[model samples]
Target chain A: MFLKNRNIWLLAPAVLLIGICFLFPVSWLLQRSVSEPVWGLQNYITIFSKTIYLGVLWNTVAIAGVTTLLCALIGFPVAYSMAHSSPWIRKVLIFSVLIPFWTSILVRSFAWLVILQRGGILNDFLAGIGLIAEPLDLVYNRFGVLLGMVQVLLPFMVFPLFSVITRIDGSYFSAATNLGATPIRAFFRVYLPLCLPGLATGAMLVFIISLGYFITPALLGGRGDIMIAQLIFERIDEFGDWPLASALAIVLLVGTGLLFVLVNALIKIRGRGI
Target chain B: MTKTTPKGGLNRRTFLKTSLCASASLAALSIGTRGAFAAVDLSGREMVFASWGGSYQAAQETAYCNPFTKATGATVIQDGPMNGSKLRTMVEGGQPIWDVVDVTDTFLAANEELFEDLDFNIVDASPLDQAYVHAKGIGCIIWSYNIAFNTDVVGENAPQSWADVFDVEKFPGKRALRDRAYPMLEIALMADGVAPEDLYPLDVDRAFAKLDTIKDHVIWYTSNSAAQQLFVDGEVGTGVLLNGRTFDVNKKGAPVDLTWNQNIRSIDYLVIPKGAPNAEVAQHFMNATVDADNQALMANTLAYAPCNPAAFAGVEESVLPWLATTPENAEKGFLIDAEYWRDNLAALTERWTEWKLT
Candidate 1:
């Protein structure tokens, strides 16, 4: 009994750190949501009732979902290649993926702005090549925002998926191949199922991070792309509406929490099926 | 892992005692140094002065902060690009950190409870423009949002008015505007031919309709620096920019030209946060900052106009036209109605968000 309970005690420091740093502040914010400016749930009501707020919330969710989907589609093949490649090639690929991580997000966003704006490098290149008569509107819109977000978030997806893919025994593929299955068949039956946990994890990480994104979208995207984070920032910075901002934040928190739970439940059901 | 026995006849307990003694002595040494440091006669008081950063803060440091520190012997710590929410949070948490903040008059007017009432005696209101001096704040800088264009792109046919900014057919390029709703609406109204004197109780519907015409050609800049960068990079042919930003870029020989026609002028104020840790020292700092010579120095450095009328005495004649507060420049531009905005900003902001999304 003593030994069994000792492991629980080992978790105390981590739990205490989280309580002091994250949970305490969050709880205070939650309390403020319902208490400030005459003390009621009016802030939440206003958020729910306002079409603009709801539109922003929907826009945030849509952008996150799309970014996650794109990351999964793009990152899976790259991560798989990295996992199966020669050691030297794998190292090069890994270094390339991580090089972006070392660059500041602001710098990356501004770089994208330079490359995509009118009369910018991309436009100059295209014009020089006689590809078009006019410069393309490649930035300050949804396309620019997506490009920036995917660039910033791609490595997040790749690293997790790569770690998981590398852990799978190489023998599983050999065994499947020996059982008269084609490479594609082996991948679908043996490899794809094995990649699920990492896929889900990478998707979840990308999605959650994208949901709270402020700078990339603000800098690159059009007015239509104003996310929840920007709205919350403006509420506090421009309007001094803390209660409303808190209420909006709580809504985002609860929504993200619900998503996490839903994803975990789906994973569990998939596990049972396997 | 097996625990290694201590060497040199020093056990764990003895080592711990020695280390503890060493740390205690180190702390005592630090305290002694701090005491010696306090001998400069500021009563060991320090105050935080919050302002927008970059060259602006650097100029303030040289023009205002250093002078204040020299005169009063009080330690002044510089902080921020002022954040309204952080100030609100600090005040709400009952541990206000910033002693004084530089903020727009609109912001100070909106968040009155976050600041302490200014005592005229302490703040020395004599040098300041009486129109800008308030119960809760003293004017720090008066600036304008004017029509600024890249001369290399626009050349001799540079946009001279807000209407030209809205006329993409004539200009034939992207135009940048601030992301905020404030001066945009005012500019839109002006572009639509509303005279300056007849501008308020603003025709919001008309402004939105006029804005719709150029919405496709518009790119929104989130900050002054971003706007300046856009101009310097030639990403936008013209933009509605703060006078200081255009001045900085032009000073750097960026071919950015400023036009004061239909410019919207506003005042930024310096105020002490409610329950600031060093409110008394903050008052002294404020008084020093508003001195005519300091204001002129700040104006010369940043090209934003000084709040003190007497500052003009110190400004060079050639630089006067560039300033927002010059009688000629001020006469050409319209004053932003802070009182009207104080009442209608929230509603307009909501509509502005919806319009942007659409």
Candidate 2:
């Protein structure tokens, strides 16, 4: 009935625009993944048959998981502090965290390359103080990937946590304290539980984003830390094997989507309990 | 898709190259007839040329783009770091946006059928010597990859050869090499005493074996940006570098110096997509890029030398030494066997992967 009363043609241009722009290309990519026109299943077949593809997938998941965990570990405390800090302090903290997000992620990844390179500023400082004989392997390795990924994805965690934490009534913390709970107990019991949804959402966003990350790992990661996006990029660009690259891309998309759904389902279950 | 014969495939490769040359020259002749295309006012037609976007963007605009508009009249667009992935998308997507593309030497033969036969007719090949390719216009010019060193780091006494790069005991500090294996293997072999000319028909196993000798000392950086930055930061004393990036870094005050003593060169052809809307225009644009004055301007801008041997005429003698195409450098530099690299990289990449991690 609402559709009957509406001017549907108003939505036609935009709907057609999106469908033509996005859906068709995405469908074509997926189609290539499964059936390379004549070479049906060859692309998908190659992915499973090759150990390198499997290694890449594992590296993607491991890097994403570790980065997500690290973002949570680091972000939660900052969010907690900001949620309780003066409004001015909260604004300042949020602004500072949000600043890196404004710059391109590729630029930020290169910055990490500068900081973590062997004989880089960090290593130079360490060696200057007689900390070690040789500058350690810092960039072009797993450690550099983590440092870059976490830096790029940190705001995604911190922002959402701040939103959830900000909504909690101070009265709940006061009431728990009035009931003879310790300040720490009252703070955690009242504040942290309220922030779980945002925390999960932040973690899920960071995880999904990191799962498809290409640049940071490509630039920073050593041989073992190669990610799926880089594999897809190479398959298409380097090897010119479009069908296999498309297949790898579709698998990555499906995997990321499934993980997002799973995380959302968990969030929903926790939402009900809350 | 690979098969080797009883003293195999070399003859077939030669035959294919010859046939390709004949057909390309024929097409180039017909397109060379300027009056046939003179009436087709290109003012309304849009063209996009993909090149490595940087100072190249400026050089291309002034050299090819503005002059093309002034001469024949057309809208020109530029894109770049062209590879097969981007080409596949443009072609297979059925929306061929680019009329011309400047691809690396490696991509030329690998995606063989995707490109339109270059018209020798329209493209002014005068600047290119007969010896340019053993055959001209089959492929023309592509930017080269060379090892750039920090002059301040090396000081007055610099390493002349790849051997100096790997001589940690002699020219000591930290050393950097490109993370990519192509030049790495070649340099490693050279460092380990393989003759420059004997470097290809590459001995992959021997190259990797030599790479192993310097494994602990090599701090490999992947990106050219990072490779340049490492020198900028004074992180590593020396590294293998891209020619254009080295110049850019030196301009940015990184105190870097480059040696073409044993550089590997890859030739990129000016070719069109099979379905390019403006194939004739693309060929003409190629000529504009190769003109002596334009070539000199492009060299001054990007430091990538034009393949047109004659284009160097107008360039000053003082600046001639730094140009990659200068005989002093070009004679010494080996033209990269891109076909060999195209075929072997994946296999060597697999081995390199295992070697690095293991």
Candidate 3:
């Protein structure tokens, strides 16, 4: 839009930087991934034929699905509470939601690892209280992975839902109440309908992100809980099998993205109908 | 924003200095290359030796860097944990970053393009043996991965052998193992009755079965580093790990012991990129690296035995028991068949994943 001399001159530098930093590396990575192996789909085929890889993929989807569900369940209520509260309460609640987000994800994941590890604080507390005679297996399991992921990704779901919830008019609920609707009935007709968009957006964000999560699963999950990201990383980092890793990455992107898009479309249609 | 040196002035000064530095750097680079196979006096030139950045790595720099610089005039710059891919990129990108890398022989075997061959003519090769040469002295250094246990956790009924490591009833505590499948599987198989000598041409099914028995007791580390940290954290009573790390805990007064009866020994080597600009200089540095004095310095810092046989003369007798290459240590442990693994890494690693999870 700006055809001015200074602005036109700035475009050259901006384009130069973007081309150098982003385009060059991505192009090289693409070329390497496709060519590094036997130049065909051998690496990609290996991903499907490989039972371990498929199992890891299945576990990754399962963990992401569970995490997204948990985030939605926990986040929905908080968003509801904030939406119904006074402005002061809403501000305080939002601040609380954001407090943990400021800390590093690594720190948060490590904190959960400590709590969930065998002989960790949680196990010690349980044993001390005579709840169990021995420390139960906790960390390095599916449970630990879920716990860490839910903590890291809860805010992603909550905030988007909060935005939509806050926009829901109190008048709509009051009118439904006045029109012979019970509190629960009024909420179903008004609150649920109003919060649909935010819920969809938040759920999609969480699901898509959970698909790509690397650190939490690797750190917390046991051997059986290996995820796609870790597998892709291993292919490239450990084996130096660039083509295979790229193929894995490509599959992950396509599979996770398609599922997310399909779900988003379904939700959008249903929300519109409601 | 106020009165300051103009853009032209700044550019001119920068240009002049950069040109001077570039010429000086070119001359130094050429000199190092021309004397590639010769043991040139390192007294004036600064040399950068790369390593896996850690405590022992720090010791290597302290013991060798300062002393080597003082005595030889080679200002040593210690860099890195070995990364073959990253090094390749640097060499390919037109700037050679590291001259000497402290990497494992396994890595050199897997990624042969990343390191310069040792100049055996100048670098003393007399200390190394037939087995070591066949193993490729630069690709991997002779090192051990052994069984370690917390003395306090196991008490008087300490693990006599790796059989003791698997004895849940005897050594009753969480057992940790490195996340890798290579040496760990071998340890598991040995515990399951496979002779160490017969471990070559690995029996996949038997190895998996052995691993399965301890899967319940074994806390397999996804991050190898986590194995040590877990033991140090007192979460695990017993584990199989790199002897160096297990030794660190013992040195630090942790109640731990290393069982080398069935320890795995392998070499980690050094190499130059296939088309590296610094290949010639790298070869010179490699020559300096394998020198008896320098290799001895590496041993003192790393605790892992030095590759140069001559370096053994410098290694103290007190440390001989721990060095992987000592006649005592070498007699017990067999060389890791890297060639077999090199041929079957892809297939076997896939099997390793299934075995670990299953």
Restricted to chain B, the TM-score per model reads 0.85, 0.82, 0.79
Report the lDDT of model 2 for residue A92: 93
Best of the candidates, DockQ: 1
Tell me the tens digit of each residue's lDDT in model 3 across A137-250: 888888888888887788899989988877877899899989999999988877787888898888888888999989887778777777888877777666777677777777
To one decimal place, how large is model 3's interface RMSD in Å? Answer: 2.0
Ranking by lDDT: 1, 2, 3
Interface RMSD of 2: 2.5
The worst-scoring run of ten residues by lDDT in candidate 2 chain A lies at: A111-120
Per-residue lDDT for B309 in model 3? 63
User: Which predicted model would earn the best lDDT?
Assistant: 1
Residue A132, model 2: Cα distance from true site in angstroms:
6.4
Q: lDDT per residue, candidate 2, A143-244, as tens digits?
A: 888998898899999989988888878888889999999999976777677778889989988998999898888777765677888777766777767677
lDDT of 1 at B116: 91
Candidate 1 docking DockQ? 0.50
**Candidate 1 lDDT, A1-274, residue by residue in tens:** 6647657888789999999998998998899899988788999999999899999999999999999989999999999999999999999999988887898888898899889998789999999999989889999999999988998899989989999999999899899999999999999899888999999999999999999999999999986889999999888888878789889999999999999999999999998887
Candidate 3 whole-model C-alpha lDDT, 0 to 1: 0.69
Docking class of 1: medium
> What DockQ, on C-alphas, does every prediction get?
0.50, 0.34, 0.37
Q: lDDT tens digits, residues B97-188, model 3? A: 77666556556667665545555654444444546653223522468877777777776766656777887887776788766777766777
**Model 1 agreement with the true structure over B267-331: per-residue lDDT tens digits:** 88889999999987887777766666567677878788987775676666667878999888898
Worst 10 residues of 3 chain A by lDDT: A29-38
